[model samples]
Target: MGEPVNREKPLRVGIIGCGKIVAQYLESFRRLQDVQLTAVADIDMERANAVAAEWNDGGAGEGGVRAVGVEELLAAPDVDLVLNLTIPAAHAEVALAAIAAGKAVYGEKPLAATTAEARRVLDAAREAGVVVGCAPDTVLGTGIQTARKAIDDGLIGAPVAATATMVTPGHERWHPNPDFYYLPGGGPLLDMGPYYVTALVTLLGPVVSVIGAASHTRAERVIGSGPREGERIPVEIDTHVTGVLVHESGVLSTLVMSFDAVATHSSNIEVHGPQGTLAVPDPNHFDGETRLFRLGGSEWETLPVSAGYVGSGRGYGIADLASTPEGQEPRAGGLLAFHALDVMESLLDSAHSGKSVAVTSRAERPSAVPLTSQEG
Candidate 1:
């Protein structure tokens, strides 16, 4: 691995995978000065070329984003960090390759398809002395962070429990290539659970055990968008998953994720304590209203934005990584991602075994981010 990122300079970034998600990150990267987009690569040369041509560095003088081969980009001298936007199944493989190349890595969520693979990524980064960061940086935004501030300020009193619900028809409705979504690495639980579970951990604490039940609503889904519209794809993963996470602190978080449901009026997340109930906004988004309802109150009150990166988005986690002091983990560090993955994976295992499964891994609630801005 390489030395610590120099805080005085922008962390030069090379991106891998030019999927739909890459656009969001590119938009965020343009607004973040802490990290520079240096290069891009994808299995599809057209995608690599398209993204490389799409990014306008505006003369930051880092030579602009170049379309290079995966091996070339990984071995590039100007690249300090690899921003992995690969599919969930290839997450660990790319992270390991970046670590092997001695470049620090920050990747999209789950860390890997399974905990076993995730541990290897973490272990390799550790042995190589490089940093490993992962996504759902949405929690580092005002919505969840303001909720965190409220809890930390004791406004919620002794945190008792939380409920996180995400209901969607399915990604095939919109995603151009949604096949992988039904495969091993994708599912409502693994696909959308990271945001909710990570938020639960952020609000309550680390989960010690989980009890879950899952079901498959259908074996095939007809595509509703793009050239593949109306095409049917096999569903190899659970479509709906409901679980109870027993936090180490005794806070129980109930999780409901589904691709089968039409809609729900429930808050994305709600934390209940003796004093009040907090209406946390969507964890999948960067900002929204974080409301609170006191024990004696009849109506929910919108709380002020008291924490998190202002105007943050997908790539902000990498910027956060660049700003982190050496020897300290970024808020979106690998540990949290791994813990979230373990909890989700355990829930599925429990779903299969028809018994509660104890989560062996734990991640500390990352340090709270004060109301801050990446625009600065």
Candidate 2:
């Protein structure tokens, strides 16, 4: 266990990386009393300044969020936790820096570039006695949590298999900085697979082994919408990846992730069983309708909102972490992120080796979220 959280005070937060995703977290921080956004930083100082200048707390408290250099944010006495939103490749580096500075950390997913690097980050946090939380906290919201409750209630009756599918043309179309998406740690599987994989583990259990294959569809892609529109960028990682995961619970999950497809009609995730099939919502979003089709039923039915943060978003995981007891893992914790990373990396390894790979790492299925309201 790490040092105990002081229940009377809010966890002061400093955010690193002012990319597109920072906007979402900013909105959530406005709602969470468990956390206070104290500072914003980025390699691009202008971007950091803009974020600090734009955020408003509606006169709640804390004076205001200020812009700071990366080094300055890490050194700030007010920041009790560092929110690392850097690119996948920089995840471990930033987390280690924050841990070195004696701050808790919560980052956007895939944990790190690889399981080995993620292991280093977690080891350092362990040695430093700081808590580490990672995202795709979307699973902590109603969609997946309701689905989880359904299965736990035996609505699916011993899940036999599941299919998770996510396909996108690419992030270059919308993101101003899209260069990192094609890098080693930023491929389709590594970039987007965390949501599906983490959700699968949340609803099912940890994976023990996996078989996989992958493809690279193009040499380069043109920026579709951004300051650099029409500029072509080289693709370094496989754009499409498919894999089958063998779960420790005897459940199997088949995953399909691709940046090559224009679109797809498949449900984000579907679980099958002797009793029924569940159409889980897109794991990327916080809330959506979860539908169910029973063995003898002719029509699909939508499940009621039975679990999760009713209207939560990106950084609720940090609030969850702040509220977690001393010895418990946050719903979106590092162990799960590391296990998900190992699964994806192993899938790619299996893709290259043409053989099944054993996933040596495993994480407990994170605790399910009860129905919650963060409206305070």
Candidate 1 per-residue lDDT, tens place, 95-173, comes to: 9999999999999988999999999999999898999999989999998999999999999799888899999999999
Clashes of each: 0, 0
Candidate 1 regions exceeding 4 Å error are 57-62
Worst 10 residues of 1 by lDDT: 56-65
In the order shown, the candidates' Cα RMSDs to the true structure are 1.2, 1.4
Which residue pairs does candidate 2 place in steric collision? none
TM-score of each: 0.98, 0.97
TM-score of predicted structure 1: 0.98
**lDDT of each prediction vs. the true structure?**
0.91, 0.91
